[model samples]
Target chain A: MNRLYHYPLSPFSRKVRLSLAEKRIEVELVEERFWEQDADFLRRNPAGKVPVLKMGNRLMAESSAICEYLEETHPTPSLLPSDADGRYEVRRLVAWFDDKFNSEVTNKLMGERVFRKIMGTGYPDSANVKAGSKAIKYHLDYMHWLLDQRRWLAGNELSLADFAAAAHLSCLDYVSDVDWNRSVIVKDWYAKIKSRPAFRSILADQISGFPQPSHYSDLDF
Target chain B: MNRLYHYPLSPFSRKVRLSLAEKRIEVELVEERFWEQDADFLRRNPAGKVPVLKMGNRLMAESSAICEYLEETHPTPSLLPSDADGRYEVRRLVAWFDDKFNSEVTNKLMGERVFRKIMGTGYPDSANVKAGSKAIKYHLDYMHWLLDQRRWLAGNELSLADFAAAAHLSCLDYVSDVDWNRSVIVKDWYAKIKSRPAFRSILADQISGFPQPSHYSDLDF
Candidate 1:
């Protein structure tokens, strides 16, 4: 069995978990205190980050890499398309969520509001929070624009791109930071993805100190 | 000829350029002012980012995606390995460089020292620069550790991961921000990669008003 070192609210970890679940790969979930930088965890990932996967003899770090590994080894219920161009689209969208979206929305909003408090960095800066709030609208609008053009963020078929976007949004939703009403397309897309059987574990994730928003676990939400 | 819309100093663009060079794919380079958000460029990528690839009738955005696409379509001198596990390792390292490295080091250092001056976001924050400078040492140490174990970043073979790391470092090196003496292994590894013919264009890159380091183009440096 594979073991995953992760944090409940981390979108990167959530993205890996979602990919594992989608591929029907079983993994033992081990909550890691990444901020603390535990020795054992450090051994698993010298970088001292979450979403590290211990699979067989290989200990892998980085969500994108772990997800792609799972997709390649499992090959069932494929998360990436077979074609090169199609695969490129999926990887691009995944990068978009992990890099751009995380920077513009998740890190700014969630990092300021949640992680700052947890890490004892300082109180959340209202100005940064407000900026994050405004920035999210643009991202959500971008998602809507993409969804309007295709059935999924990448194309007409479901791919890892959707999961990547959802993972980030779900984390934001946990803190009640996401305004689902911003875009009907994005809302419907989330509803479709969240209702999946694979999403059950992610939906059930509970962090002791951080209480989830009321709508976090609701299927219809 | 394939056309790449990019900025010479953009790490993401540099990653794609390195990958194309490694794969021996010839592309016409078009430097894009992403900050300008030109209408034509925006039409190419709704997000208004580079490096975007225009290949025949198909236009693609995002560095990871473009690299993957190139790897698939041009399988000669493969950037990724044949096995699933090997490919996973490569992808994982790529993500480490592209996402974590970019966030922890590149964004902090480059955004503070270079981007702020270009965007006129006010004077560079010494605190941020100090933090970035400090953070990079940690990242360099981590890279050195990885290089200690493997011939290349992902494994025995050169892969996209090396290009990703080199791209980020090259951008910093252009501004003389990288402390090459921090790790002998890292320096040797970079020197080996820098000596490649693929790195020639990157070495020659010049950003107006921002001069390159004295050794930026020195193959033997």
Candidate 2:
């Protein structure tokens, strides 16, 4: 059986989880306190990162690559489109969320509010948090702009792009960082994605110290 | 002909250049002043990011996605292995450099030392730069540990993983941020990649204000 070592609030881990569920690949979920730098976890990924997958004979890390590997290995319910251009769009959106969005929003807000405390880094800087809060509106606007033109962030079909975006936003939503009111289209898009059977586990994720917002598990919110 | 809008010191752009060169794809290189954010460049990628590729009729953005798209569309000399497990290993290492290395080293060091001056953000933060320098040693050690067992980063064959790791290290090396002597294996691996025909343009890269190191252009160091 495949085993996933991940943190509930990590967008990258959530992405892999969503992809596994999407492909109907059964895997054991092992919550890893990556910050602790456990010896066993380090053996799995010398990099000491979360979302490391232990498949039959292979261990893999990195969410995007893991998702692609799963997609290629398990062809049912594809998360990526067939065409090269379509695949490019999905990959671009995934990078946008994983790199850009994570850098701008998730790292700023989550890293500030929660991760800092968890890591014993320091108190959250309100300025950085404020900047993240403001920047999220702009990102939501961009999402709304994309959703306006297509059914999904990349195109008419739901791809890993949607899962990547949802993963980050869901984590932020858990900390009450997302303002769904910023864009109605984005909200509707989230509602649709959240309603997926694959997302049930993600919605049920609970961190010991951090309490979920009232609307985090609510599909209609 | 394909055109790449890039900055010499940008690791993301460098990764794309390395991939293109490895695939034997000739591209007209256009040095983009991402700091200036030209209107024309913005049209190419509204995010106004570097390493945007204008290939044939398709305009692509994001280094990771562009690299994957290139691998799919131009499969002649494959940068990614054919097998599912091999591909996973390659992609995982790619993400290690692009995301983890970028965050821990590039953003903290380069963003402070070089990018801040270019973007007029402020003077370089010595503390952040020091932290990045310290963090890079650990990352280099990790790379050495990975290379100790395998011929290349992912495995025996030279893959996208090598390019991804080299791309970031090259950028840091440009500003004299990397201590190459820390790991002989890592240094040898980089030297092997640096000697590649595709790395010629990257080695020849010149930024006006930031001068290159003595070994920057040397095939052998």
Interface CA RMSD, all predictions: 1.3, 0.8
Clashing pairs in 1: none
Q: Model 1 off-target regions past 4 Å? A: none
lDDT of each: 0.88, 0.91
Among all windows of ten consecutive residues in candidate 2 chain B, which has the lowest summed lDDT? Answer: B212-221
List, residue by residue over A38-151, the lDDT tens digit for candidate 1.
888888887788889888888999888788878877888988989898899899889889888898889999999889988889998888888889989999998999899999
In order of listing, the candidates' clash counts read 0, 0
Worst 10 residues of 1 chain A by lDDT: A205-214
For candidate 1, state the interface root-mean-square deviation in angstroms to 1 decimal: 1.3
Question: What interface RMSD, in Å and to 1 decimal, does model 2 have?
Answer: 0.8
